[model samples]
Target: MDLSETNQTAYRHPWELSRMEILLKELEKLNIRGEVLDIGCGDGYFDKEIIKKFPLITNIWGVDIHAERCVHQGKEHYVNSYNELQKDKKSLILF
Candidate 1:
């Protein structure tokens, strides 16, 4: 399937929406306030949503094997591997 089509499907799927809702609820409970590292972040869609919902997040980064697919406001926000991301900063990691 086309990547664009897959993204459209994910947005439209009830199960996928519900899953994201649940994940967001869980994240809300944490009251996280810091950087976030999303591993295997495809297209960085969830990362965008996360930052939008949680303004306390100072920064958000995406790590994906297919780095070219990651869509972020800034290119530096996406990396090809965890090792490429700065290790010193404390961040909430999402899979």
Candidate 2:
């Protein structure tokens, strides 16, 4: 159901879930491997969703400019800046 139709507090947003689903499908088709990095990963919501659907991608990382803006609902290797991540390797970076 839509959040507007429910009396309970929203745990997930429909739009976000839809976007994740599309991304998940595309990623699955690619048969991706290695690390995944989420930039400006607010609250790590998408990270949790991705991790839940793609457990094989264990090396996931999240980076946000301000640490305070992030929420750690799931266990993620969060960093304060993109500079903290490796510059040499290609990564699946999401904005």
Tens digits of per-residue lDDT for model 2, 39-69: 6776666676777787677666766665654
Candidate 2 stretches greater than 4 Å from native:
1-10, 71-76
**Cα deviation of 25, candidate 1, in Å:** 0.2
**Lowest summed lDDT over 10 consecutive residues: which window, candidate 1?**
1-10
Clashes of each: 0, 0
Strongest candidate by lDDT: 1
TM, every model: 0.77, 0.69
lDDT of 1 by residue, 1-95 (tens): 23355654345456556767999999999998899887777776677788899999998877776767774444866555567777767558898
Q: Model 1 TM-score?
A: 0.77
lDDT of 1 at 49: 82
lDDT of 1: 0.73
Q: What is the clash tally of candidate 2? A: 0
| Global lDDT scores for all candidate models | 0.73, 0.65
